[model samples]
Target: MVVPAMQLASKIPDMSVQLWSSALLRDLNKACGNAIDAHEAAQMHQNFSQQLLQDHIEACSLPEHNLITWTDGPPPVQFQAQNGPNTSLASLL
Candidate 1:
């Protein structure tokens, strides 16, 4: 789930607040199916889910310097010293 979220964000041309929300919502619905349902409660829950994912995405997104390489991609130079064999996109500072 974490990897999927990161991939979604990284693919964005520009991670604006609006784009982030809509993209996340679209992906969520596509992966898990639409949230719209016959019951009012279901709609409410769907909204809540979208909001929760939005919040989570924001919370997880830190400064670019704070970002780390999570996948098999090369690690940031800064990570070489502290991250050992692992590479992260952390700033040298």
Candidate 2:
């Protein structure tokens, strides 16, 4: 599920932390038919926030020479080289 969400996020132009968390929570609830408890939901949201922040920090720490191409469409082939062909935005995250 996280992999699919990551793939989807890679194509979005501006997926902010708040947007991502809300979207994930919404989808998770929908997928589970709103069965998740409030505490569990909060925990999941917190995890996503922390993970995204860590990932963003890791990305920013990379040398300037390693570029991240932002786009509404899927990242290009050359851009995938930075992470690997199989995981386009995985490295960025």
Q: Judged by TM-score, which candidate is best?
A: 2
1-93, model 1: which lDDT tens digit per residue? 533544454455543543454555556665665444123223433555576678778876744333454455544234445536644454432
Clashing pairs in 1: 75-87, 75-88, 76-88
Model 1 residue-pair collision total: 3
- How would you encode candidate 2's per-residue C-alpha lDDT over 1-93 as one tens digit per residue? 644554454455554654465567556666877655333545655656676788789878765324454545644433436544655543565
Q: Model 2 segments beyond 4 Å from truth? A: 1-36, 65-93
RMSD of every candidate to native, in Å, equals: 12.9, 12.8
lDDT of 2 at 83: 48
Q: Rate the local accuracy (lDDT) of all candidates.
A: 0.49, 0.56
Quote each prediction's TM-score.
0.29, 0.36
Q: Which candidate number would show the highest lDDT if scored against the true structure?
A: 2
